[model samples]
Target: MKKKIHGFIEKIIENDIKKNNQMILRTRFPPEPNGYLHIGHVKSIYLNFTLAEYYNGLCNLRYDDTNPKKEKKKFVNAIKKDILWMGFNIKNITFTSEYFDILYTYAVELIKKKLAYVDQLTKKEIHDYRGTLKQKGINSPYRNQNVQKNLDLFSKMKNGFFSEGTVCLRAKINMSSSSIIMRDPVLYRVIESKHYHTQNKWFIYPTYDFAHCISDAIEGITHSLCTLEFQENKKLYEWILTNISVSNYPRQYEYARLKLEFTILSKRKLQILIEKKIISGWDDPRIPTISGLRNKGYTPESLRDFVQKTGFSKQDSLIPLHLLESSIRKDLNMKSIRRMAVIDPLLIIIENIDLLHCENITVPNHPNVPTMGSRKIIFSREIYINRDDFKEYADDNYTRLTYNNEVRLRYAYTIKVTRIEKNKKNEIIKLFCIYDKNTFKTQPKNKKISGVIHWISKKNVIPTKFYFYSPLFTIKNPDLEKNFLNYISKKSKIKKNGFIEKDLPNNISCIPYQFERIGYFIIKKEKNKLTTCHQTVSLK
Candidate 1:
């Protein structure tokens, strides 16, 4: 409902209600319950729901479950959960299959009116006959069958008398029409799988094109919005509605679908990832699926802000991945509380500090929002700092700890490293430092501090696995490759056994916290087992 770039679609809706007293804005988010909802679907989801809300109308969450082979109740539930997570209230939950009886009758009426027929053409023959734009399509051998015969054949198809794909009912629209969707598109098909909603009561099912327009009409949806890929199908959509006695069928409008670089929006490709064990599951943090993003610490406000900022338009464009990140960064910068994590811990022994001298340091939960209060972190003789925060070598510009360099500890005393300890392989295992004995925050005379570094007491830290997640594909435009998987980022997810302050929250509830120098992270689970967490974004 946020004000975005106004396009012609908004004008159309605004003008429609302006003209007629009876006009009411209604919309629906009709998703095929074939797989879990993904990020691409988010734009359409919020658009439909928010538009209805903007007009003081209602939005329905409808599952276009005509294809029972891939559709399942679990998928329906998952989609519902995702929509709810987006912060919208869906009052009407309907399925296209719920109108199967009416839809079947409509098919019968179309056949009776000689607007449709059952075609016996094989799959290859149908494609061969559909003819390219340069050539006109040849009529199917069964195109002129009598309405009675077509009706009987369709009835037989519905009764499961024929094997799947043996025959299907097709609209008898102009075969030579330049729009291929109008070249006698399939209106009904034989899907023998038991539907999750209707069980085995029906064998033949209406195709997406056949059910979608009529469903919108039946629901009295004022503006049926779709992605630009279906723009060509609009003619067929209106034609079906006009011929089917839908007195007040909804008008269809097409806008660009959300496309992200290094991401595939195709449900089929996402299913491939699940099928081949390419990733963990539908909710893999690497995937563009909504559940995946939600688990990866994405907030709904950030998602909505992302879509609104991207703006709705008719022309499609591939969006940079950083645009999405920017939205998240903008959202979390004001909210995510600061925490300290040492992913690659280097022991720092403060030789001058002991149990008696050590004290608890209090830091603001959020530097900007004092209302979030503060948390206490302990300091002791033995503590851990990030290994990258120190090195055996240094330059004048080096802002972090180096051999014999003085640096300020975040929310703690200043220290000067005396020596670095290494193991047999020459890995810097620890650093010995002497802390300033001053009881107040102070700058060492004759030296400006290098930089502030975050550390935790070695005695009271909790070790947890932190996952650094990047794009699933290595290349920016991965979908261009014939084998998108060839560009799959092997290091899309990297796990580190990290240490966090012992006072950190045990339950995250999907809220991400900034880990000081590290990125934002949220607790995640795999297969019901609490597992490695994910980095939502980096500080830079």
Candidate 2:
């Protein structure tokens, strides 16, 4: 079934279809490939691609790789891989560099029409002249240069005659206009750095504001979708397209961008984390990058569901991180195989059973999913359980293991703790327990066992490392701080030794598993004699 489209953007598109009758909707996701894509970009990707699919239209993935100073071929490739990982099979992949010749022609057309001029103003001078929101901008002295002279200068700028930042092509728009973006925005600038795609082919490149609208028009895009931050720039987008000779003029619409709690999506900030070695890379599970979440075992379905629930809106708001966690939890609950793992393993010896005895117990892979089948787990005289599951003393409300208390072992017998062994420091080392042989599927006569704990036999267990991830930032909105790095969580990631059922596949693959009482986790890396699993979310 086609997903119902009912956002404000959808209303606009529906009205446009009604007005144009036969308009074939076309949208594009234009990303500047300087860093890995984060969850914020996923929202845009979901919106554009899903809208196109729903309207029986098309969406294109375009790289707005105009800034050669930071953009790289590696980033371009990473962006493509991330999109594909999100299950978007975009065939119309393109780059702004591909349309450089035509963009240059469009700039020349604007210059010849006295709509653009070559400015020799320094960077600071241009910034000073642009004016703030409270004050109107002053016109540049070069604003009135003749079309012939401007054209000669622009050609020279493009031909590498001008040094970087010395010359730029600015549109001849109103300087005193209420919109600062329309106050003669720079259309092109000279950059000496070699572009990843077109190395040294041209000395000048178009700014995003200039190249974006023209690129949309050139590609015959009917609806240009953007975040609300671009609302002020919409006027410039329209003005440039209106002045250009393009056959098609795309309309720009703005919606709220994703502002996720506890994480900053700024590429510059993320890069800083990388440069400081604060994270392994962009894919560090603690961050919100798409690859990071994937590495943490988040499914594409959950991310798409998150975007859908976030919805489209005109007003900006910060989305709670739990909303995303809830989506993934709901998804993993249905799909993940159930297994028993002990993060902080505590030894428990069943005294009644023979030390050499081992029994095979059958457990469903997924309790609700019968078709998922079942696996046999070893039940031996000695087993391991999470230290958190056992308490030396507990209140009546505590249902987990306690000294002299009986608790049901998941898919096994009910066990009663007889005693505990402690180290010299008073830390509990292990527990000695006795199991009721007949309580695997029933309560012991005249007694109720409300607590059920997961356990793995000490025999044939896979030694594993577990990573517990918390929010990268300590505050709800780290972006509010002048230096977001100050709010970095000291314990964002905690690693510990653990054990998983021996029945687990040798190659666990990327699929996550519900670690019974612990949490959902997926195999992250495997080395000789040890496997590493990353926690996706806690059982709660």
> Model 2: runs farther than 4 Å from truth?
none
Clashing pairs in 2: none
Per-model TM-score on C-alpha atoms: 0.96, 0.97
lDDT: worst 10-residue window of model 2: 523-532
Give each model's clash number.
0, 0
Span of 10 residues, lowest total lDDT, candidate 1: 524-533
TM-score of 2: 0.97
Could you give candidate 2's per-residue lDDT for residues 165-192 as a string of tens digits? 9999999998899888899999999999
RMSD list, candidates in order: 1.9, 1.5
Off by over 4 Å in 1: 1-6, 355-357, 524-531
Alpha carbon lDDT of each predicted model: 0.86, 0.91
Candidate 1 TM-score, C-alpha based: 0.96
